[model samples]
Each structure stands twice: as structure tokens, then as C-alpha cells.
Target: MSFRVFGIDAVSYSTYSRLQKGLHAISMMIIVWLMTSGYFAAYITRIPEVKEAVSAFNVALATLFAPVFVFRMCVSFGKGYADVLRSNDVMRYAAFVVHNLIYITTLIVIVSGFLMVNRDIDVFGLFYIPAVITDPRLHRWFSDSHTLACYGLALLLFMHVAAVIKHHLTGRPVLKGMFF
Candidate 1:
């Protein structure tokens, strides 16, 4: 569905903002999926097909989401956006904390999968990032970090959704300000 607000015919945000938001949504969904997939990978690592598919998905998601995240971080410093972020400093701070939590969690997830697999893992059999170093300690650390981050992310995401719902139900202009 397209984004619309009040009487404005435009989508929820500008083209760039929409793309950023779309990526945000896609990345979030994929990350959630990857978390579950990681559990499956851990329990069913013996399943060749499950391992291969999960590994490929992990690599592709990492590759796709990284640039989108980088761009979002860059644009976050631009003018005008500050106004939207200022709706409520307390909540805005909470959102910032949540964003960072997601970012760190995302990085750990990618790092874990990359470390767990051999350098030969390829996405779509087209691109690859060969592991430069091998140490079981490093891989295990990444995996454990990824697991912890995912647990924290669950709480962060819950708070974020709750805040959004609060804004919507409170009849505040917060959601509107974000799109404008």
C-alpha cells in the first residue's frame, strides 16, 4: 500500500525517504526471519538444504541491508529531519537507542553467519566474501554476540512499536511529522 496522510496525495515521505523507509521495513522483516533461521541452523545444521539456504539468505540480507543502513545513517544528519526527531526528546532518545540496538544486532548477525561458514559461501552463486581469517573463537564470539543482540532487539522493537501505537492513538502529530 502507498503512504498517504490527511489530504496530501504524496506517499508518506519523499522518494528518498520512502526508499529508506521501505528498506527499513524490508531489513527489519528479513532480520526477524534470519533470527528464526539462525535457530533452525543451530538445531538442524545437519540438514544440508536448510544450512545452504539459510546461509545464502544471511549473506544476501547482510549485503543488501548494509548499504541501506549506511545511507540512513548519513541522511540522519541533514536539516529538517531534526524537527521530526524532536517530537519528544524522551521518546526520540528511546528511538535512537532502538536504532542503534538494531544496527549493532544486525552487524553481529551478519558477522556470525560469515564466520560460521567457510570462506566459500556464495550468494546466488554470484558474489562472495572470502573469510580472511579462521579462528573458532572468533566465530563463536560472533555467534554469541548475535544471539544476545537478538534478544535485546526483541525488547527494543517491542518498545518501538508501542511508541508508534501510542503516537497514533494519542492523536499526536508525531507520525505525520515523520512523513512530512
Candidate 2:
């Protein structure tokens, strides 16, 4: 099935499953929020209370998101890989590379963020996740890794958006395939 808007045939672009689209939308929203809030809390604020609140909220959201993200990775990775391997098109290959990089970096960010916590994680005061690493030095290392991975993920996200815009401008609208 496909969609038509403004005389454009969406099926001629890239069609994703409803499940894929839903997962993509949810993941995108959460990731964008987390990244924005994290950056704001880290760099844009001098108020300790505001920073703490943002950090707590982000931690809870991320903890809940980790499993969902892993599920998304499992669902999307193989299909993306197969598409790239089967296609001789350069654009396909490039898209696959960039998409995989985003996935890998996101995974790193989630893992490192969890590892970097030196204390138990309180999820909206409902549950707690105990810190796995006890060593302060290891925590610092993971914290650094999380920050670096976040920067890399942000760059890749920009490239992904740019590619989507480029495709749309070239008269092939891929957004229709990914959205309702």
C-alpha cells in the first residue's frame, strides 16, 4: 500500500511497515528530547536545582527507553543490512552506513549513560536501578564516552535529516512512507 499527496506517489519512494514507522517516530521523539534536555542541563544552565531536575527526568526516560531501543535495533538492523547488500546503488549503501552509525552510536550512548551513573537510578520514584560499576574512575570514563557518543549521534542525525530533505527537494518525498 502507498499514499499520494500533491501528485507524488509515496510508494515510489521508500515504504516502511506501520510497526517500523511507529517505532521510528517514538524513538526519534525520545532521542531528540533527551539530547536537547541533556545539552541544556549540561551547558546552558547555572542553576543546580534545574540541572538536577533535568538530569533526573532524563535518567528515568532513558532507562525506560533502553529496552525499546534495543527492540528497534533488532527489528531494523537486518532489513537495512539486507537492503544495502542487495543494492548496487551508492545512495543505498551510504544510507545504510549512516543509519547503522546512528544506531551504533545510540546504543553506545544508552549503555554508557547507564554505566556512568555512580549512584542508584530512581525512575520517577517508581523503581530504582542499581549502579553496576562501583569504581569512580570507571564511571568517569563511561561519562566521557557517553558525551562523545552523543556528539557523534547528533552529527549523524543532522546528516540523516539533510539527506531526507535532499530527497524531498529532488521530488522524491520519503516522509510519506515513514509517516501516516
Candidate 3:
């Protein structure tokens, strides 16, 4: 009666745990890089090639990351919502909310990135995803929202990491649950 990842009946906790860990690690690394990429591009723009390279890299990373993230979101919330609700802990619920927000914001940022005009992206060096937005107003709006969402994601990530460290320091095995 429950949703399963890939409809596999015997999927173990260890399997989902590993999937979450890998996806989380990838998400964190990409986000951290993306947070600074704007500033980095500005600084290196004197060499126009570097700016182009940076833009291409950003698009490529997002292209590869999108599906993995979407998959993780699907698998993570499947059947876990009931467990989260039944736990009856405010902190756990808060953590779940923060996690969902992080995922939502990241997806928003990714979509906005895709919508932004002027950047030509050869995703994974195979196919190109062109900028479909040409309206200056809408483009600016999405671009600005993408930037804000990146900042919000950074803040959420900091809070999440701090909570994990706090749990580890306070001898709550919740941090260990993430690993084993």
C-alpha cells in the first residue's frame, strides 16, 4: 500500500540511506560552487572566454543534477511523510520542512537558470539547451529570483548542517542515522 523507489519490494533502509547521502553530498557541493560562481565570473570577465566557460559549466552541472535531484525528492518523500508526521517531534518536523524547502528552492533556481537568456549551454557536451526567454522584464525577474533562491538555499544548508553537528555534539544518534 506504500510507494516504493522503482517499485522494488525489497528495497532496504540501507539502500535509501545511501541514495540520500549521495544526493545530499552532490547537492551541497554544487550549491556551494554555484553560490560563489556569480562573483567568480565577475572577477574573471576581463578574459571573456572564462566567463563563457563559467556559464557553460553552470548549465552543464544543472543539467546533470536536475534528474538526480528530482529522483531523490521523489524517493525521499515517498512513504516517509507518514513516518515524519507520526514521530511527534517538533524538531524532526522542522527538519523535514527545511529539507523540503531546500529541495524546492534548488529546483526553482535550476528552472530559472534554464529560463535566463543569452547563455548557450551544451549540456554534458552533447546537446544544447537554449535560453528560451527573451523578454527583458521576465528574464530579469527570473534571474533575480534565482539569485535570491540561491542565497536562501545557502542559509537553509547552514542551518541543516548546524543541526546535524548539534545533534552529534548532544549525543543524539540522529546524525549517525544519516550515515549508518
Candidate 4:
């Protein structure tokens, strides 16, 4: 099927924005659940199996979303990076840094997770993502790095949400950009 918006033979900008926001919301919810499980469930639980399950789930979810996020970013921020950097607007420049920080921290978390896995993972029992790290020391390093990167991502996410609320509350209606 073919579609057009305003005589332009392409999807409308609003439709693209909605799709991007939908993907972001879904991905963030998964990531938050996985990240929090590591900090909460892994520690309070007495059973080894439960901790292992959470660990496995985190890695599987992170692996699955990593590429999808990268593609979403590329599509959403076509020239915004360079344009924002060149602009004199302090808010825009700061937003750009925070935005890139989220991406950098996410990639770090994913890569560090891949480096931390010790055994081949059977993702939801559908397919396998093979172990990428073997050495105990290297695995430990990656594990620590993964934990730290997850924290970094979490902080960036909080800031991003607060910023949106701030803009919306201050008569900006930035949230409307995502919906309605």
C-alpha cells in the first residue's frame, strides 16, 4: 500500500514521531525491569536459581533491544547532532549531550553484558546467543562495567523524563510532541 501526507509521498512526521516514542517507551520499560531485578531480586532472593534467572533475563533483553535502539536513534536524529552542537542555545546543547550520553551508556551496558556472559544463553528457549567471554578476570571486569553502565543509563533516563516534565509544566507542551 502507498500513502501520502500533505501531497508528500511518505509517512507523516507525526506518524514517525509516534512510532519512535512507542518503541522508546516499550524498550525503556523492559530495561528498567531488567535493571531493577539485578539490584533488587538478585540480592534479596535466597535461591541461586532465581538470581541466575534474573541475570539471564537481563542479558537476553539487553541483547534483543540493543540493535533496535541503535536503528531508532539513527532514524530519529538525522542531523540533530551536528545542528545542536553548532547552535548557541544552551538548552539544546545540553539536551544533545544528555541524549548522546544515554546512547553511549546503553551501548556500553550491552557490550559489557556480552563480555560478561560465561555460558551460551538460550533466549526464552527459542535460540542461543553464545558466550563471548571465557576468562574469569575479563568476565569480572565486564560484569562490573556492565553494572556501572546500567546505573549510568538509569540516571540518564531519569534526567530525560524530568526534562520532559519540566518542559511540559513550563508551558512548553514538549510531551505533546510524542503524543496528540
Candidate 5:
């Protein structure tokens, strides 16, 4: 609030600016939780006896959040271009929305991965499911889906961070939305 650019006060963006900033921060915290849970499910529980448990955790998370991500993306389409475009005031929301989409889409990848893993057991020690297959016939299918999803997410994230940096270099409030 103290800073001004070209004598133009930050008020030009209006009060939604602060609310939007808060949303961005909250969204990020949620994503961190989602990713942490995913990492634990995917990488930490590696025992064959409990492998299905971890994969099941990822599946539940994905199925639950997938709809939420779709809803968010759908809402973004309704936003006015002026409001949605890359402005410092809006960048956090934009970044948050973009990553939410990424996280949500990855749900499909995770589910597909569990199928690919081909183990049948109770996931997270709750639900019992049969193994997908003993043979690796569908290995390529799962690998391709998971790999492609990760690569796409990585590219989108890179472009996103780059845009924020660009906004900062150009003296926009891009960093402000994320930090404060």
C-alpha cells in the first residue's frame, strides 16, 4: 500500500485485490498439503504388503479434488479478461488457479498409476481392491499417462513462475500478491 508506480496509487486495482491475495495464499497452502499427501502415498509407502494402501490414498485424494479443480477451471472461464489477465493484483489468483488445475488433472494420472502398479489390496488400510494385472501388458499405458501428466504440469509451472518474474521485472505487484 505504501508503494506507488508512476504516481498511480495501487488503489487502481480496488479492494478485491486484498481478498484475491489472501485466496492465493490459501490456495497455495492447500496445494502444498495435496502434494505432500501425494508424495507420502506414492513414494513413502513402498512395501509390497502396503503398496496398495498408498496408491489408494492417492486415488481417494484425486477423486475428491478432481471435481473441485474442474469447478475452479470452469469459473476461470467466466472471469472477465481484464480481471483474469496478468496483473500484479491478479497474478496470485491466476497462479493458484493454474496450479489447482494441474493438481486436479494429476488425479487421473495417479489413479491410472495405481492401476499400472497392478497390486490389489486395501488402500490406506481401508478399502480392499483386487490387483489390476499380474502381467505388465498395460505397463506402457500407465507409464505414458503418468509421464505425460508430469511433463505437462512441469511446463505449465515453469511458464507460470516465469510470468510472475516477468511481472516483477516490469515493476508490477506480482510478487506482492504471493508474499503478503
Candidate 6:
């Protein structure tokens, strides 16, 4: 469960199961793509066509990702909570807090994204999901919530990456634990 990288012993310090690792990898890839493309469409684009395309794609992607994300949440939360409660390390507790915040914000983002939809969700033209809220006012509120939660999730993801880099640079190589 350990290997050498650049002449250093990279030990697998994580006890995550194969299922957890797989789920994490899937969720991470989708979330990162969604967030990056979303920000690009919102802040970097002036073309209406480009913005609409990105928006439509992201909504479809997110709709499909929802169930996988919920499953990931279910698998992760119990183990993480138990580990933090059993550990006396302050860093573990800190990581737990940040991790939970990320999960919560992600949940909010997904839910609000769904609720904010003013029209039916067309998932890659496979099927259509009916709009949950009919009120424009409620849709606007959920849209705002989704935006704020996305920003919060971005910050948390940054901290998460920074922490992993810090660990790796310090010889902990915690990043290796999450990989095969």
C-alpha cells in the first residue's frame, strides 16, 4: 500500500476503502469540472451563446451527478465523524470541520441548483426532470443560495488542496493515500 516517489517513500496513510476512493475520484472530477466551467461561463464570457451552452451543460451534468454525490456523502460522513471523535489530534478535528463544511455547501449547491431551475431539467436529452419550484421569487432565492454555496465550496476546496500540498511537502505524502 506504499510506494516510492522521487526517491521518497510515499506511504498510504489513509484507510479509505476502494469504494470510497472510487467515489471520491468520480465526485472530485465532476465537481472540479463543473466549478471551473461555471466560473468561466459566468466571469470570463461575453458571448451569449457560450454562456447559454455552458449553463445548459452544467445543469445537465449536475443533475446526473446528484445521486452519486448523495451516495458519496452517505459513505463518507459516518466514517469521518467517527474518526474525528476518536482522535485527540487538533489537526484531525480541523480537517473534519472543513470537510463537513465542504459537504454541506456542496449539498446546498446541488439542492438549490435543482430548486432554482425555472424550467424542466433536460439531462443530456435522455429524459426530463420537472421543475420543483414554480414561483419566480423562490427560483431567484434558490439561485442566489446556489451561487453563494458554490463560492463557499470553492474556498473549502482551495483549503483542502493547500492542506494536501502542505502535507506532501512536509513529507507526509497524504495525497498518495487517496490514489491507487
Which candidate number would show the highest TM-score if scored against the true structure? 6
| Full ranking by lDDT | 2, 6, 4, 3, 1, 5
Q: Judging by lDDT, tell me the better candidate of 5 and 6.
A: 6
Ranking by TM-score: 6, 2, 4, 3, 1, 5
Local distance difference test scores for all models: 0.64, 0.90, 0.74, 0.76, 0.58, 0.89
lDDT of 1 by residue, 1-180 (tens): 454455334334342466556666666677677767866876757988888677677767666666676666565545344664776677666666676676666666566556665466555667766774588787677767767766776677777778877866665434554442
RMSD of 1: 4.9
Give the per-residue lDDT of model 2 (tens digit) for 1-180. 676756766664555777888899999999999999999999999999999999989999999999999999888867766767988999989988998999999999999999998989999989998989999999999999999999999999999999988888787887777865
* Candidate 6: C-alpha RMSD after superposition: 1.4
Best by lDDT: 2
Residues 1-180 of candidate 3 have per-residue lDDT tens digits of: 322332323222342477787777777777778767855885546778888778778778887888888887887766477788899899889988998898898888888877775566788768887668778889889878877877787788899889977865654534434443
* TM-scores, one per candidate: 0.67, 0.92, 0.79, 0.82, 0.52, 0.94
Error of 3 at 36 (Å): 3.5
Clashing pairs in 6: none
Cα lDDT tens digits, model 4, 96-175, are 88978887887788788888889997677878978877899999999899888878888998999999878756655455
lDDT of 5 by residue, 1-180 (tens): 366644434433433344455655554564455555655655687676565554466555544554555454454444455554555666567665775666565555555655665666454455666767676868668866876775566566577778867865676744554444
Off by over 4 Å in 1: 1-16, 39-48, 77-89, 173-180
Q: Which ten residues in a row have the lowest lDDT in candidate 2?
A: 5-14
Between 2 and 5, whose TM-score is larger? 2
Q: After superposition, which runs of candidate 3 have C-alpha atoms over 4 Å from their true positions?
A: 1-16, 42-49
* Model 5 TM-score, all chains together: 0.52
The CA lDDT at 109 in model 3 is: 84
Candidate 5 collision pairs: 53-124, 120-131
lDDT of the structure predicted as candidate 4: 0.76
